[model samples]
Target: MTSVDQPPAFSDGAAVIELLNTSIGYGARAVVDDVSLRIDRGEVVALVGPNGSGKTTIVRGLLGLAPVVGGEVRLFGVPAGRFHERWRIGYVPQRHTVVGAVPSTVQEVVASGRLARRRWWKPPTAADRAVVSRAIDVVGLVDQSRASVSTLSGGQQRRVLIARALAADPEVLVMDEPTAGVDVASAEALTRTLARLVEDGRTLLIVTHDVAPLAPILTRVVAVAGGSVVGDEPARIALSPASALAGGIYAHPGHDPHHLAPDDPAGPAPGPGWLGDPGLRGAPAAS
Candidate 1:
């Protein structure tokens, strides 16, 4: 396993992410209602659910991508809206998010993750270059670092996106459908990568349909169905052979909730430059 540098210390027994009786949705419709969850430092939490079951909404709700209509949302013990240390939280969107008409090299794409933390006027230092290189190497894409992102396959692109998130060295890594559409080999590679990250003491919030690849390292499972948490189990119990026989740990169909249609009236409009991320520069104002 590749070694991640020593991570910044986190307060013991404190929640990295907390949602208390939270309600998240677009405008009038509530996708996730009264969903309360707490993710502690170094914990790997999996959010499993069916399509349109509010799993993605919950993730977005925490990121301030979705509307938090009610209850409380906090990150690092601070209210989500007031939290400004966004560079500490890394987000890997679906593979399609980075695909666009403007082609960028794998190195360039991964480097974007550092923008929030980097000074706008200063050039990248040796430390920055080193971190970026490590991120690429960890994803086993060092040879393709200089290649165009458009030239890579879908799985390769996903790995690049993951490398980008890792470049940020976030305390909490949030991934949506991380293994979706990847081949078995790529999936296994990602599994190992994630295990290494967990071993390095990084907190993870993963939203996916297949938990088999991640079951071993997962500390807790938060199953959502019908826009609510239906089951929460420990990894030992959830990954047991008996559990597989009794209806597997993961449910089918974890619909990607990040994509909000242009005409969707009830959904969140997006946040404006929230968390110092330029991509979200036009998102809706905080509630």
Candidate 2:
């Protein structure tokens, strides 16, 4: 077990994610074991671990994306299967994956985030339009709202994704590797935005490798290994003042022991391109 300086502060009130007797696997093979964990409202919790540590699996289970072999998950206090609070949760995927290289305008794409709140087979209402506009403004994309997502710079595309998530005005924001691909400047900027979310009373859960750059701004950090939580602590006390914050690129003895950095001229830049990473196929732990 990893050492911790102090106990976690569990004061956000009401659980947003709960994994009870939760176990997940592929083809009857269990990768993550029975586990029970809860994330509270208004909390910013960071999930960290080595490769094949079950980070993505847990995320998928919480989102109801993958089947649960046993146990149950609850979102916003609702049973996982019956949970319909998607609009209350926002997700920022590692991939900028989208249809076509044709590129869609930032506003158009951000508007998609509100689809969950809309009724089935119905068009966007005036309220939806206002929400989208507010979301775009929050992410500082008002000027670039007309820009094409594909044509915009990498950081801009990321902002577009953030805007999409914010369009729902979600209560909790879940991000997987939110800072993996961008440059130092862009990544730092994104971190600032996340910090703002906490300041605004919105909860956030992020899976990350490093705690620096953004560490000084985080509320808590939870480490996972072998599919279970090894440590959960207050950011102010847990991480060493001198500890390295993982970012830019991680060529861990992890998911990709030899994973190349995005700047690898021969390698693909961060975004959808990483989806094709063969290293990840063998290293599900890193996700």
Candidate 3:
């Protein structure tokens, strides 16, 4: 992939990913509408919402998997549609298993992530091998590098997928449901892996339904519902255990603070200010 010769005037140098008043969906249907968001470098942002609430649609749109029907999406100061440096971003889709119909070793699977950086016909070089090994080590799977992916537990397999993404050494890592369906121990391990990535100054955009495990490390939390962002706040405020249990912030669409009855006695009914809204219901438009 080649780089853009000149960044468009609309590009924001401070933002790694910017979605300006964007709408996205399949074909003619728009699942997310007029949404604007900016993710800066070194930020760990979590997209939290119930299923079908457009969280995945936003991520897919950023990745160019879904069609953007309105506005623009930019990556690293270039229009996403024209951006050719795809290796700058690494993706880990929701996992069912690391091994497909054909089982591969953990090392082999992680090595595949480097395919984007190397020509298919060229054999792996020493540097490529070292990078792959480092990726595996980053995810804490070095000991299992030679094990068949199918033989590992669900959490270990998830790490392998992460290691594969890390192998590319992308500027940003976008993960969908990284903790989904894993045991507590596995979830903790995943969190530690992600924490390490954060310490390395890598930007991350994670889509998840459960945020408790990742709450401590998240810099920001964005709540999505009804095809729009409903809440955007610093993680300490949005994902706090108290706020979450009170249905105050980062609550699922079904439990939105606005849905609470005024006289029901679970604290006064929430208003626009509850979500840190500054007039508009969601976050202020990205500058």
Candidate 4:
């Protein structure tokens, strides 16, 4: 328990996760279209875009949760659909999954991540317990281990879900909206925990509308729009997380202008230039 486990084997120059010429969707609907992306080992890549932009669908394609209508997906050099090593990848789904009225405890929920490695009918081993305990400690939830998940706040429950993913001893973590709806304190806690994970050499692919809290540790940013990868580049620029969030890093810059008319019900809603106005870019005002 004192040392992190070694990363799984991968071929030279091979990406930890890859989607090549892929299209993913539900029945008769291709939500993510013709996307090609790669995440190398130990890289923290943020997938940012507007709602219905297929960011989550791309992740689902990687996890084999969505239908891959075309092309290929690979994890650690193995085809995603054929990859059997589930524990090598950890996933924290959107918050709604944990908000349900379930009677499970934090510890029990976290421990369930170990189920993939444990035998169907056998009980958890000493190693499983050690890892679960370590995971709880990693997320700063040792004191709340036994607390019922339903009793916890939305943010606390989110931390519990993170601990659950860590309990699997994964080399790559895929998360959707890690800080959405979370309070300031919980968001800070999550940021610190994620930084520690990156230091520990774990890779992360997070789909988020705001990367403000994660700016310090982020290595790259991948922008998805119209169900496609619009931007994929290094995030090593001078922009701080807060500034990036403010500077339209997550804004749907390509949104149609006609949709922002004054009388349109879908027009400029609120909160940080929801209307995608050009003035939001901090341009010089006309004389």
Candidate 5:
């Protein structure tokens, strides 16, 4: 197992997210303790472990949804607690969290991602609409742009949530269990869409239990168990049964070890850039 005691060397670029010996949980209890992790610009990272392993809690801590009882969490070089340019990071919650009983068009739901970039008193501009449209297209939902989110399949709805995050055009995207509970076909489709995003040079931090489908696009995998990271290694090693067993993470039956190799012709290319504007950075938050 790769040791987490020392920081890994990364390419020259600012870390998009950093957790320094951080402990996070709700109220007074700390779920994960003394965790130090960093995701540099352009890296596609996966936080993998069994359910309740504190992977989700770590993500929550980064988003400030969970209370940080120890250490620090930073976003784009600024302490997360003090960071105001939140528009720089897009988040996609689980699929179930996105759709509700209320009927809403795919376009409407995606456009909402721009809320952090638009002033409340002002309406969405042409550029905003264009960005939303591009996001929808990126997720291959152009035909369903006008379709109600409730009417779509679980996977399509998941794509909607992803499009919603992309609509914000954030530099770094953090997604939780993107392929969870989806049918095989839908999961494959989602993987292809993610491949496109990777090609566009989007920095992604994904939390997932099933990493086989996404193994191709993953650059690194950090295994968390018992509220602490047990293994950190390149995707090639991390996804193997030996490495997984070493970290106490179960390798689900039927997952081919060969797919764990990060050699997908459809995988992400080099560098950090946005979906629409490749050169943009540090986007201002909505007033």
Candidate 6:
């Protein structure tokens, strides 16, 4: 079994992620309201909010995955719509639905990340091969390089997805619900790997309903509510017992905070992070 080691990648110490009054949703009914955000190099930001509060919608807007009704989003300071520096950005979709039946080996899957690094119709360059191998090893998948993707565990699969993002050596990596249903060990491992990325100054923005798995390592948190930002503070502040209690739940099931009436809770309440034990992977999102 070949052992793969982590690599020192880069995020250029650049402010590569931003959103300005960004609004997004299906059809004409907007779910996300005008909101502006910025992420610099060497920082990690988490978006924790009540479900349907437009956290995912905001992320989709930045990725150009969802149409924005107002304001603008910039990647590397260029308008996101016209941003062609695809090679510099990496994204891990919330659903790895495409992995289930795929019969490709781990190396093959990681190597595909290089397609974006090359020109149209050209063969893979030796440098591209090196990057893919390094990416595989960095995500601790070297031993499974030749193994089929269908054979890996859920945690391994998630790591493989992240490796593809890292393989591209992107300046920004945006992930949605990255730790959903993940086991404690796998989630912690992911957090540690991400922490290493921050030490190396690679920017990361993750959208998760639960912050407990991510808070200890977070540099900041952007809490979304009512389709707009209600709080933009350090993770500790945003997830404070006082704040968390009043904020309802970030990513709670069947949540629709927009229509739900509000009432201020009288006192601080226990929560995912405030429980004092680094809790386990949170409840799963409904089907």
Q: What is the lDDT of residue 67 in candidate 3?
A: 95
**In candidate 4, how many Å is residue 5 off?**
29
Looking at model 1, which ten-residue stretch has the lowest summed lDDT? 278-287
- What's the lDDT for all of these models? 0.72, 0.67, 0.74, 0.73, 0.75, 0.68
Pairs with steric clashes in candidate 1: 26-266, 26-267, 27-266, 270-283, 270-284, 271-283, 271-284, 272-283, 273-281
* Model 5 whole-model lDDT (C-alpha atoms): 0.75
Worst 10 residues of 2 by lDDT: 278-287
Candidate 6 lDDT by residue in tens digits, 1-287: 00012111322345677776677777888889778777777667787777678888888888878888888788887888788987787888786433646599888888777778788988888888888887776667777889898887777788788888888888778888887767655665576667666666677889977666565567667777889777666555555646653355433522233312222142112353323223222311100
TM-score of 3: 0.80
Model 2: residue 1 alpha-carbon error in angstroms: 9.3
After superposing candidate 4 on the true structure, give the runs of residues whose Cα lies further than 4 Å from its correct spot: 1-12, 96-102, 238-250, 253-287
Q: List TM-score per model, in order.
A: 0.81, 0.78, 0.80, 0.79, 0.83, 0.78
C-alpha displacement of 215 in model 6, angstroms?
2.3
* Residue 185 displacement in candidate 5 (angstroms): 2.1
lDDT of 5 by residue, 237-272 (tens): 676656754244454222433333334343222323
Residue 105 displacement in candidate 5 (angstroms) = 0.6
Indicate whether candidate 4 or candidate 6 has the larger TM-score: 4
Candidate 4 TM-score to native: 0.79
lDDT of 2 by residue, 1-287 (tens): 12222223554456777777788777787667886777777777777777578887788778766778878787877887887677788988767543456668888899989888888899898989998998877666776788777776766677778889988889889887776666655565566567667888888888776444355356776767787766666655455433232221232323332332323344333345433433223222222
- Write the candidate numbers in order of decreasing lDDT: 5, 3, 4, 1, 6, 2
RMSD per candidate (Å) reads 13.1, 9.4, 11.1, 11.6, 7.5, 10.0
* True lDDT of residue 90, candidate 6: 87
lDDT per residue as tens, model 3, 55-160: 9999999999989999899998799989998888999988868857887899999999998889879999899999998898877676678999999877778878
Count of backbone clashes, every candidate in sequence: 9, 6, 0, 0, 0, 1
Q: At residue 7, what lDDT does model 3 achieve?
A: 24
Candidate closest to the true structure, highest TM-score: 5
Error of 1 at 108 (Å): 0.3
Of candidate 6, the 10-residue stretch with the lowest lDDT total is: 1-10
- Give candidate 3's error at residue 18 in angstroms: 0.4
Candidate 5: where are CA atoms >4 Å away?
Answer: 1-10, 241-247, 251-287
